[model samples]
Target chain A: MIGTWTLFQRESRRFLRVKMQTIVAPALTAILYLIVFRYAMGDRQVPGLDVDYFSFLIPGLMMMAMLQNAFANTSSSMIVGKIMNVHVFLLMSPISAAEAVFAFLAAAVLRALVVGSVLLLVLLPFSDLSLAHIWMILFYGVCGSLIMGSLGLIGGMWSKTFDDMAMVNNFIIMPLTFLSGVFYSVSQLPPFWQAINAWNPFFYLIDGFRHGFIATGDSDPLQAMGAVAILTILAVLSAWYLWRIGWKLKE
Target chain B: MNALEINNLYKVYGNGNVALQDVSLLVPEGSFFALLGPNGAGKSTLINILADTVNASSGSVSLLGHDLFHERAWCKRRMGVVPQEIAFDPFFSPREVLKFSRGMYGQKADDAWVDELLERLELTQHAHKITRQLSGGMRRRLLVAQALVHRPKLVILDEPTAGVDVELRKRLWDFMRELNAAGTTILLTTHYLEEAEELCDQVAIIDQGKLITSRPMKELIREVASSSLCLRYAEPLQLSDEDKSILSAFSPRVYDNQLCLTLNKQDSRSDFDTVYQAAKQRFGTPVDVSIRQEDLEDVFLRLTGDSS
Candidate 1:
C-alpha cells in the first residue's frame, strides 16, 4: 500500500511541479474558448431550450477540458518515462502491476478534476452556470475523467515516441470530443449525424455531464449515465489487462 | 547460502536476440563480486532480469533464499540495482528522488539516512536542484544513492563509475567499501579489468551469450600464472617476418620488452625449448627467462578471444 501511495504521489507531483503547463495552460485555453464563443453567438438560444447559448456551451466545454487534461496527464507521464528510461525504477520497486495501474489512473483522474475545477472557477463569472442535478454532475465529471484517463494509460503504454502520442490525441480524441456536441446541439444536426453521435462514447460523457448543469440536452440524462458507467468499466478493465500483460511495458 | 544464484538462465528478446544462453552464476553472501564482459555480451541482460526489468526466456533465480520471479516482491525488498543508463525525472530533486525511492520500496521515511547518503555521495549541495541542472557525474552518484536508500542486502552496481572522475570514483569506492564492510553484498559490472582485479574477491566473465569463467580472483590468477612463459633477449629484440611468423605459432606477444606466451598443456617444456631455439637464432643469447604471470586482461582476452 505504501508503494502504491508513493507511486501515486510521485506521479501527481510530476505534473503539479509544472503547473504552468499542466494546470494553468488548460484553464487559460478554456477562458479563451469562452470569450470567443460568447462574442460569436451574442443572441443565439439553444434549440428547444430556454437557456442561452453560453449556458448550454459552458458545461460541454468544462467536461471536454477535464477529459482532455486527464488523458494528457497519463500519456505524457508514460512517454517521458520511456524516453528517459526512468520507468525501470518503478518496475524494479516492490509494487505490483495492479498497484501501478491503479496509481497511474488515480493520478490521471486527479489531474482531470483539478483542471476541470480551475476551468469552472475561472469561467464562472463569464457564463450563467447553475447546478440543476448536482449528483449527475459529480457522477459524469469523475467517470468521464476515469474513462479518458484509462484510455490515456493504454495510449501511453503503446506509444514509443511523442509523435505516436500526438497521433492519438489529434486523430482520435480531437474528433470524438468535437463531434460530441460540445459547441452546438446534436438535435439540430441531420438524423444521420445524430446516429453517429450516439455511437461516440464521448457524446455520452459530454451530454450526460451537460444535463447536470442545465437539466436539458439533445439526449436523456439517465441513459447517458448508464452508458458512461458501462464504458468506464470497460476502459478501466482494458487498462488493467494491458498492464498485467506488460504490453509494451515489460520486455 | 549464496547471496544470488542462477540456474540455466536464457533470454531471447522480442526481436529474437539471444542475450543470455544457458548462463549460470552464484555470488557468495557479503562478498564483493565482479561481473565482467565484452560489449553486447549479455551482462546487462542478466542484470536486468535480476532487476525485474526484463523477463527471462527460461531460467530460475534465487536471491537471499527467495525466488526472484515467483516471489519477486519479497526479493525486491532486499535488492537494489544501479542501472547502466542515467535516468531521472527532470522535475525532481536528488533528495526527492532518494526519499521517493525508499518509499516506493515500502521503507518508512528516514531523513537522517537520506541526508547521510546525500552527504556521502557529495550531492548535498545539489540535493534540492533539478536533475538536469546537475552534472552527469552527480546524476551517477545520485543513482547510487537512490539504489541504497532502502538498504538492500544485495546491491548491484552496473557500470556506476563509467563517466565519473578519478577523485569521485575513489570516493564512491570508499562509500561502497563502507557498506560492504557493514555486511552488504555488492555485485559490480565494469569494463576496467584493473578495477575488478584491485577490488573484487570473485570475478565472472561472459561473452557471446555464454559464461566463460567464474571463480575466485586469486585462484584464477594463480591458474593463469602457471601457463605463462616469458623469454628475454640480450638486447632490445628485433625479429624478421620469417622469425616472427614462427613465433606467432606459439601465440607470442611482447610485454615489457620480453617475448611472452602461454604454455597451454600440463607438459609444455618441449614447446618452451622450441621457442628458445627460434628466439636464440633471431636475437642472440637469452639473457633472462622466467615464468610470466598473466593479469586479468590477459585472462579475459584468452578466454573471450577479444583483443580490443
Candidate 2:
C-alpha cells in the first residue's frame, strides 16, 4: 500500500509539476469549448427538453474534460517513461504489477477530478445546472474517469512511441468523444447515427453524467451505468492482462 | 552462504536469439566479483535477468538464498541494480528520485540517508536541480545514488564507470570498496580490465554465451603461463639467415624498433639467455632488455580468443 501511494504521488507530481500543460492548458481549453458553443448556439432548446442549450452543454463539457484529462494523464506519463527508458526504475522495483497499475489509475482519476471540478467552477456563472442527484454525479464522474484511464493505460502499454499514442488519441479517443453528444443530444441525430452512438461506450458516459445534472436522459440511467461499469471492467482487465504478460514491457 | 547462485540459466529471445546458454555462476557472501565478457557475450542479459527486467527462458536464480522467480519480491527488496544505460525521469530532481525509489521498495524516506548518499556521490549540489540539467557524469552519479536508496544487500553494477570521469570513477570505486568491506556483496561488469584486476577478488570470463573460466583474480592471471622478452638495439640489427631461423622458432618480431620474443612457461632462463646471445652475436650489443609477465588482459584475451 505504501509502495502504491508513493508511485501515485510520483505520478501526480509529474503532471502537477507541469501545470501549465497538464492543468491550466486543459482548463483553458474546456472554457474555450464552453464559450464557443454557447455563443454559437446558446438560446436554442432541444425538442423535448426545456433547458437552454448552454445548460445542456455544461454537463457534456464537464464530462468531456474529465474523460480527456484522465486519458491524457496516464497515456502521456506511460509513453514518456517508455521513450525515456525511465520505466525501468519501476519495473526493477519490488512493486507488483497490480500495485503499479492501480497507482497509475488512481493518479489519472485524481487529475480528471481536478480538471472536471475546475471546469465546473469556471462555467457555473454562464449557465444554471442542478446538482439534484449528487450521488449519480459522483458515480458517473468517477466511473467515466476510470473507464478512460483504463483505456489510456491500455494505449500506453500498446504504443511504442509518442506518435502511436497520438494516433490512439486523435483517431480513437477524439472521434468517439466528439460524436458522443458533447455539443448536441443523440436524439437530434439521424436514426442510423443514433444507432451507432448506442454502441459507443462514451455515449453512455456523457448521457449518464448529464442525467446526473438534469435528471434527463435518452436511455435508462440504470442501463447506462451498467454499460459504463462493464466497459470499465473490460478496460481494466485488458490493462491488467497486458501488464501480466509483460507485453512490450519485459524483453 | 552464496550471495547469488544461478543454475543452468538460459535466455532465448522470441526471435530465437540465444542470449545466455546454460550459464551458471556463484558469488560467495561478501565477495567483490567481476563478470567480464566481450560485447554480445550476454553479460548485460544475465544482469537483466537477475534484475527481473528480462525473463529467462529457463533458469533458476537465487539471490541471498531466496529463489528469484518464486520469491521475486523478497529477492528484489534485497538487491539493487545499476543498469548499463542512464534511465531516470528528467522531470524529477535527484532528491525526489531517491525518495521515490526508496518508496517503491516500501521503505520510508530517510532524509539523512538520502543526503548522505547524495554527498557521497558528489550530487548534493545537484540534488534539487532537474535531472535533465545535470551533466552526464553528474547524471551517472545520480544513477548510482538512486540504486543505493534502499541499501540492498547485493548490488549489481553493470559498467557503472563507462562514461564517468577518472576522479568520479575513483570515488565510486572507493565507495564500492567501503560497501564491500561493510559486508555488502558487489557484482560488477566492466570493460576496464585494470579496474577489475584492481578491485574484484574473483573474476569470471564469458565468451559466446558460455562461461570460459571463473576463478580468483590472481589465479586466473597466473593460469596464463606465457611471458614475453622485449629487446631494444642501439640501432637496427641486420640479421643473417641463420639468426633469422633461430629467432623464427620463438616468433620474435620487430615491434616499434624492439625485437619481442614470445616465451612459454616451459621456456627456461637458458632459452632467454640463448636468445640474448644470438642477438648480441648478430647485432653487436642490445641497448635494453625487459621481461613482461602475463596480466589480466592477456588472460582475458586468451580466454575470449580475441588475441591474435
Candidate closest to the true structure, highest lDDT: 1
Name the TM-score of candidate 2.
0.92
Residues B260-301, candidate 2: write the lDDT tens digits: 666654434436776677666766666889987757876676
Candidate 1 lands at a TM-score of 0.92
Q: TM-score of chain B only, all predictions?
A: 0.85, 0.84
Backbone clash numbers for all candidates listed: 0, 0
Question: Fnat per model, in the order given?
Answer: 0.83, 0.84
- Candidate 1 Cα outliers beyond 4 Å, as residue runs: B226-260, B263-273, B278-292
Name model 2 segments beyond 4 Å from true. B229-262, B267-290
Clashing pairs in 1: none
True lDDT of residue A57, candidate 2: 85
- Which docking band does candidate 1 fall into? medium
